[model samples]
Target: MSSPAHAIYSSTLSLSLQGHAFHPQYGVQLIFNEIAESLILCGAICSQNPSCRTFDYDSSSHRCRLFEADLTNGAIIAAASQTSIVGSVILSASLYASMYNQSCSACQENRYQTCSSTTNTCQCPGNSYWNGSMCPLQLFENAACSQIDACRSDLNLSCIINSYGGFTQCLIGINLFTIFVYENTKIVQIETMSDYASLRSNDGVVSPNYNFLFDENILE
Candidate 1:
């Protein structure tokens, strides 16, 4: 293989798996593939592409494959050949600014909405929820929630009052079941779905003071 031209290794890349390679599975997609004489050449090619998030370099074949894959997007299976290395780009680095050279649609100049490294669109900075047209401020998925919109809008989670009695509206003749809530104002424990039909068989009073909260993660 011919040696690759001397190019400065950009500080925006990080090695994920050394001496390891991955092949596309059934539904995997790739940005492009090319003959790369060295690992540096493979990474340089990935840096040149805006959508290239990962790259795999095969030492024996002198080939490189660029992909939009990432740890959160999905996992790639390892190949039988162990003479390769895999690297991923840092989304939060200055490289992102250069990657998104083109202007994003509907992105206001001074709205604090930056370009999303994953979606390549204009969205709220630091994982804020984007509501298509604009980024609406929202709480984290694992944080203490109070209102129905407490969690990220993308998650589409239901708001259940923790430490409350039970969901009176959840029960209907034979089609519905009672959902019991906890009584702790500051719910620090995980709440499970408890269905009791006998307790409130008929019309029951709904508690006015439904406070405390529990996310879908802690619910079973």
Candidate 2:
């Protein structure tokens, strides 16, 4: 009969070991119905593969966990031993590290513009305006104003007008009593008043019974 193979013992899990090996590491032990054979196979696998850092075998389910590198001590160990084999695999580094390239530049050039590394946006020229992902329109300078004017239309107030300005001005009498300048030229003024009463009263100077009385509340 052949002698049983002795398990290889090491202070830490072997980085090259995978699957079943000839023996478990120093702190590690195989708990399987066929512990001797399982340990031998795992040790052999780990020795052959450089990427295989560590491995675990479940006796119950006959499953194996191959790790690219050893994690923390308790992290790779199973919480409970069961009849089924259950295992977990760990890569050499975090999975995301492998997915993204850290050395790549931040900005990329497109057809319309060159993207900025700091702002992560396309750079548009001074005369160009950005439209969505591309620069579409060029900007131009605006014309200056030409001339302005001022005038008066009604009783006690003055009116001012603008030549090249966008708006017009006019004076308006409130309640036929006080004269106030209204900037917009849309309203029309009809008759004049001596005082606020003549302005607010129903009878104007054209009426025979016109009585001009200055009401103090009008000033208030």
Superposition error at 25 for model 2 (Å): 21
TM-score, model 2 to reference: 0.21
TM for every model, in the order presented, reads: 0.40, 0.21
Clashes (N, CA, C under 3 Å) per candidate: 3, 23
Colliding pairs, model 1: 163-182, 163-183, 164-182
Best by TM-score: 1
RMSD of every candidate to native, in Å, equals: 14.6, 35.8
- Tens digits of per-residue lDDT for model 2 on 38-127? 644655454334334455665545555444333322243333554322232322222222212121232122112333343333343222
lDDT, candidate 1, residue 170?
15
Give the residue spans of candidate 1 off by over 4 A: 1-11, 23-28, 93-220
lDDT of 1: 0.46
